[model samples]
Target: MLHRLFILLIAIVGLAACSGGNNFSSGGATDVARSYTLADFSFAAPADLTVSESENYYPFADVVWRGDPRGARVPQIAAMFETAARRSATGLTGDVPVAVQVRLVRFHGVTDRTRYSVGGNYHIVFDMTVRDARTGTVLEPARRVTANLDAPGGSRAVALEQGGQTQKVRVVNFLTEVLLAELS
Candidate 1:
């Protein structure tokens, strides 16, 4: 009976460990050009920015442990950025003549096979550029932003999808901060 109880305890612990937990951390901004406050950085009011998905950007291309297909990658990523941008714009008071361009660089997450073999948290990285639309001058040079995120789930596909969802939120937050920071 003691041996059976021990086995049960071990199983419970194992399951708990396997269950997802957040190990997220913002990787701090890198390759930044210079810092500018809202007062220093001036642009037109009613800010409008454009988000473009690079040719090689593939957030959901490969399938590690396929369940249901994730469908198109570009549209999904574009939509995510668009949605986030709109939310971020709401915080701004006036219009800005800056055009925001983004390219998703890396999106690494766990798969069914790697989840156990490799112990690394999921992460997303992207490059952003804030430019003056009228002058065509680079306000904020291209900089890479990386953030570690919580794992989505246990199953491979579900995890990937969930990871993407979390990534979208991170991207949105990052962009919003950038916009608000420049204004401040």
Candidate 2:
């Protein structure tokens, strides 16, 4: 009778463990969204400064991942920088004496099940150069800006989308801060 009772107890414990609500097989997971704050920039700009143009140097122009084409991503990123620069230039009244050129240095997004539980990470790098409108003299050297963002989702596609959205916000904030700090 004691041997039978021991076997019953073991079965009960196994059932309880299997019945717990926290199940990993269903892909239920969560991750923390990172937060960012703009830095206090303190550089003086010429009174007649202006934004000239934005450019993209992302190497993989025709690459695709998970049904998304690289053509789409590259243009979107370039447009973001252009829009941000224009927005930042709104309050300034000038004769377009100087133009700000933006260059996208790198954009990398990756997923690793071993590294992240719910999602992966995205990294973006860019540079801004200020030059004289007429003579092309370099007023300020290239200023590099970078951001590492977290993309949290249950699947790889979802994670990539999240990372792209986060990158947009970071880029806008970074550009705005740079313009306000150096060109204001």
Candidate 3:
């Protein structure tokens, strides 16, 4: 009976959230969106990332971005964010345009050992602030958001890589959907 009650409560919450035409659940990023759509938003890349210093810096780094065809630079991530932002703004017919200033705090990719032994999540941590797109006025204060993605390991990882679902692809697609949800 308790289980049924819990499930019913969850269903009610889901309905309430979706009633606003926004779902807080997706691939990895959860509740990163608001209820209403904005006029527009753009992704602005960080000038430089603060990477990990330790040799095994696989985990403790803010700017540990990798697996980008265009280069492991933070700009690529910004570009991906831009693409996703554009996708998210498709329904933005309002008058308040905004820019998402992203400062990558950490982008932890799975190490080879972890990738082969067991899969993990790409820990993407960043600080985001919304500003007026036309002017430089700040609209929203900075907030830290984590948008993680599962990193498949071993043969499964290989298969995904071959299918063109590289980390870059997956991340980009995930961000797009996340932004869509966030702005919707």
Candidate 4:
């Protein structure tokens, strides 16, 4: 009876956390994307990502790890970079209201980990490019972006863990914003 009760409790909790939708939609960077689409330029990502999980360690946004059990993954940062590049091309066209296309020229993921004074963590690097959709000209060229995922060094969850996810997401947002600013 105890085992059954435990299973039931876990089921209820998991159901509460599950997302209602299967599709993920990330808005383009407004700063760069005043106008644009994916057909314009080419892109390349980093190599591959391998993420470990911990109850206390979390991402800033509703990011989806390579194999997230929760199924609440957000669009990867590479997509955001490409979107921003498309928007930049739109900006270059003087917001002429033409539909631009972006192509994925390359996509790779590079994983690296580091040990800070506080903890050990990993980051995924993504490299890509964006260009003119119709004319096939390079828009932003190829650039690399990195997203860090940190794991607490200690054994148990600390009070700081409460905001870890929010902070990580904020860092990602800042990175995207900066990239868009530079590309556009």
Candidate 5:
């Protein structure tokens, strides 16, 4: 009998942990930035991920939400950026090879009704480092790329999509642009 009670309690706790305890609305929605600009590298974005709309990550609330406790997307994006950095600026030849390191920290949320469809403000930071592939010399110190997306609606789903891919793309583009500018 005692074992049954313990099992029930464990099940309840597991369920609660899985579901983020936030009442998110699914009515309003908008894309923060369909796309962003950068030099040498450009990529398309679906939407911006609003930190506010993130049920688990409440930047303003002084909370950090590890959507994937294993830390997945951030590393993937960082690897992509590093690969971009290593490629030569030229088409297929005469491009200097380089390497880069990236770190994506927690993001910040602001209130901006005009820019983002998310209807709130979004701010995220990615720290990066660049080095020469051949000489192994440090090319740039860690940089923090920040951007805000439009969240015109008050929907968490919209915000997640935006903040997840769109915002990261912009930041990656921003980093690429900065790197290209320096190289030029």
Candidate 6:
């Protein structure tokens, strides 16, 4: 009976340890730029990982997301921006590529009401630092950037989404464009 109680207590503790934790992943949802955040717009990363240069990382803060779904996550957002950075990297002409260190601050895509009506802005703000891929040298110091774009709305929004220019796609495109201009 005592042995059974001890085993049960161990099992309970193990379960608690596993389920009671949240981890920060290097890659975003689809393995894309790397992650760059949490709910309450707050995120706490797992304590073990160290920020490095060669491995792309986008640190995050308490993100303020309005009109986004509850399922919106930092990993997903980080993945989106990372993917865009990769896309923009293609435009880099030199042998050594550049890295973008982005710390996301705010993002608000079209709300349902705005999407159905006169459209809105995908208000995205972040602090970005550009670095040399080979040397980890800062090409550009951290600068706050606002990468907002017009979100198509009403029938146009729906049509674009149906055609695959979704909120994700548009935002990614906008970010890619932003990075390209910034890098240049």
The candidate maximizing lDDT is 3
Between the candidate structures 2 and 3, which one is better when assessed by lDDT?
3
- Using all chains and alpha carbons, the TM-scores for the candidates as numbered come to 0.46, 0.43, 0.63, 0.36, 0.38, 0.60
Model 4 misplaced stretches (Cα beyond 4 Å): 1-118, 146-161, 164-168
Cα displacement (angstroms), candidate 5, residue 89, comes to 7.2
True-structure lDDT of candidate 1: 0.45
Off by over 4 Å in 1: 1-69, 94-96, 109-121, 152-184
Model 2: per-residue Cα lDDT over 1-184, one tens digit each: 9998886576445333323221111111123121212121122223332221222111132211121233455555566556666666665455445566666655543323311333333444556566656666755667765544443435654564466644356545555554544454
Each prediction's whole-model lDDT (CA): 0.45, 0.44, 0.59, 0.38, 0.40, 0.55
Off-target runs (Cα >4 Å) in candidate 2 are: 1-70, 91-96, 109-117, 149-174, 178-184
* Runs of candidate 5 exceeding 4 Å displacement: 1-95, 108-118, 154-184
What is the TM-score of candidate 3?
A: 0.63
Per-residue lDDT of candidate 5, residues 1-184 (tens digit): 9998886576445333323321212111223111211123322222343324333222333212232233534344445456455442432232444554545554433322322323333343455455556776755555555433333334653565557644344444544554444344
| lDDT (C-alpha) at residue 94 in model 6 | 51
Give the lDDT of residue 175 in candidate 5.
42
1-184 per-residue lDDT for model 4 (tens digits): 9998886576445433332312122233334543334334433432343323323223232223432234322335445545555445444534322333323222211111111123333333444455555666655454544434343333322334355643234334443454444344
Ranking by lDDT: 3, 6, 1, 2, 5, 4
The model with the greater TM-score, 1 or 6, is 6
Model 2: pairs clashing at backbone N, Cα or C within 3 Å? none
2 against 5, candidate with superior lDDT: 2
Clash counts for the predictions, in order: 10, 0, 2, 29, 17, 3
TM-score of 5: 0.38
Residue 148, model 3: lDDT of 64
lDDT per residue as tens, model 1, 1-184:
9998886576456434434544333233544443332222221211222322222111232211111235544445455556656665556544445566666654444444434333334454556567766676876676666555443434653455466744345445654554454333
Show the colliding residue pairs in model 6: 33-82, 33-83, 36-58
Task: Indicate whether candidate 4 or candidate 5 has the larger lDDT.
Answer: 5
